[model samples]
Target: AQSVTQLDSQVPVFEEAPVELRCNYSSSVSVYLFWYVQYPNQGLQLLLKYLSGSTLVKGINGFEAEFNKSQTSFHLRKPSVHISDTAEYFCAVRAFYNTDKLIFGTGTRLQVFP
Candidate 1:
């Protein structure tokens, strides 16, 4: 089965601070990379994806990530994060041919303290 690893479980930062969430994956073949953000009790929303072409991908809410083939990693980054950006971020991966489900990492919680 495909697997993903989230380096950090929690990250605390002040409002308007910069944040980064590291993610790595292990797959036998090519895969799709995705970042999902979950705010409080709400469901997850697609932040960004690296499907094909270009190593860098940009997502909603002023967030972005870079796909590194050599490292098998997709790291999320935001230059400046607001209080609203505080949420649980998850790194996920899907096999190129498998449409059944997505493999997700443990997750990283970004707490923006005011």
Candidate 2:
């Protein structure tokens, strides 16, 4: 079985501060990892994804993640965050070359303050 773990349940940070949302996965098969964000009363939006190619994958909203095969980790990082960045961040993974089912973490709430 494959699972995802989010190190922090909640992260509070002042505006313009750097933030890193830790995520680690356990899988016996090859996997594709992803990061998604959900704002208050909004749906989940894709932050970044690691399908193939480079280890460093960049996505919208100034977010990026590096896929570490050895560590079995895909941590999301933002150099600076804004008040608008406050939301719930999720780490998900899907079995490579398999079903569309996605395994998600418990989620980390990013609370950005002024």
Candidate 3:
């Protein structure tokens, strides 16, 4: 089984500023990681994923993440955040054996101010 931890519960940033939401995972076995974002009154939407190959993965809304095996971390970053970017973000891990189950971090609230 794998577990995910979102280092920050909340991150506030000014509009157009760069932002990073830290996430770390613990697992002896290999795992697939994902980042999802939820806007106000909306369900979680896929932001990016790290299955294999590339260490740097880009996703929707100009968000990107780097997979660091050495640090066991997959942190999400956006160079220029917008006020509309204010939302809740989650980090999830899926162990290869348990394809149907995903262990998710508590979540991080990104508050983008104008």
Candidate 4:
């Protein structure tokens, strides 16, 4: 069975501070990695993805992560965060095949303070 785990259910930080959201996955086969962010009362937007190459992947909004094959982990990080960055972040994995379904982690709520 394929599964994803988000270590932290929530993370709070002051504005303009650094932040990291941990994510781990367990899959029998190879999968595509993705990080999506959802604001309050809104849909999720794609943050980034690790498809085939490059261990380190950079995303929008000054966020980035490195895919650790040995550890089966992908952790998101940002040097400095803003209050507007407050939202729910989800890590997901999709099969390499044409399956549209994605297995997602529980999700991590990031609260950016002023």
Candidate 5:
């Protein structure tokens, strides 16, 4: 079984400031990691993913994450966040064979204040 853990349930940051969302995972076998965002009244959408290749993976909306295997972490970060970036972020992991099902974290609500 695979599981994800979001270190912070809520993150408050001022507009145009750099922000980082912490994510950790637990899995007996290798798994694919992902970051998804959900806007108000909207379903989740993929933000980024770590399938293979480079350890540093870039995502949509100016987001990027680094996959640290030893640490079992895939923390999301942005150079400077805008107010529109406010949304609920989830960290997920699934086996390479299983792409449809995702083990998600509790989710972190990013509040970007003006």
Candidate 6:
């Protein structure tokens, strides 16, 4: 079985500060990593993903993540953040070929302060 673990449950940052949300996972099969952001009262939006080919993957809103197979980690980083970035971030994973089923971590709440 595979599982995801987000290193942080809540992250508070000043506007324009850099942030990194840590995610680690363990699996027996090849997997795809994902980061999704959920705005207040809204649904989960795909932020970035690490499927294949590239070790580094970029996503929307200047967010990027690196895939480390040996370390078994995919951490999300942003050079700068805005108040509007405040939202719940989730780290997820799925079997390499399975797209419909996703195993999500206990989300990290990003609270950007002005």
Per-model TM values vs. the true structure: 0.96, 0.97, 0.97, 0.95, 0.97, 0.96
Assess each prediction's global lDDT (C-alpha) against the native: 0.94, 0.96, 0.95, 0.93, 0.96, 0.95
lDDT of 5 at 105: 98
How many pairs collide in each candidate, listed in order?
Answer: 0, 0, 0, 0, 0, 0
Query: Can you tell me which runs of candidate 6 are displaced by over 4 Å?
Result: none
Q: Total backbone clashes of model 3?
A: 0
Provide C-alpha RMSD values for all models, in order.
Answer: 0.8, 0.7, 0.7, 1.0, 0.8, 0.9
39-72: candidate 2 lDDT, tens digit per residue: 9999998999999999999999899999999999
Which tens-of-lDDT digit does each residue in 45-104 have in candidate 1?
A: 999999999899988988999999999999999999898998999999999999979999
Choose 1 or 4, whichever is better by lDDT. Answer: 1
Q: List the residue pairs that clash in candidate 6.
A: none
Tell me how candidate 3 scores on lDDT.
Answer: 0.95
Q: What is the TM-score of candidate 1?
A: 0.96
Per-residue lDDT of candidate 4, residues 1-114 (tens digit): 678999999999998889999999998788889999999999999999999899999999999999997899999999999988999999998877847889999999999989
On TM-score, who's better, 3 or 5?
Answer: 3
List residue ranges in candidate 4 displaced over 4 A: none
Q: Cα lDDT for residue 21, model 6?
A: 96
lDDT of 5: 0.96
Question: Quick one: RMSD of model 2?
Answer: 0.7
**Collision pairs in model 3:** none
**On a 0 to 100 scale, what is the lDDT of residue 70 in model 1?**
93
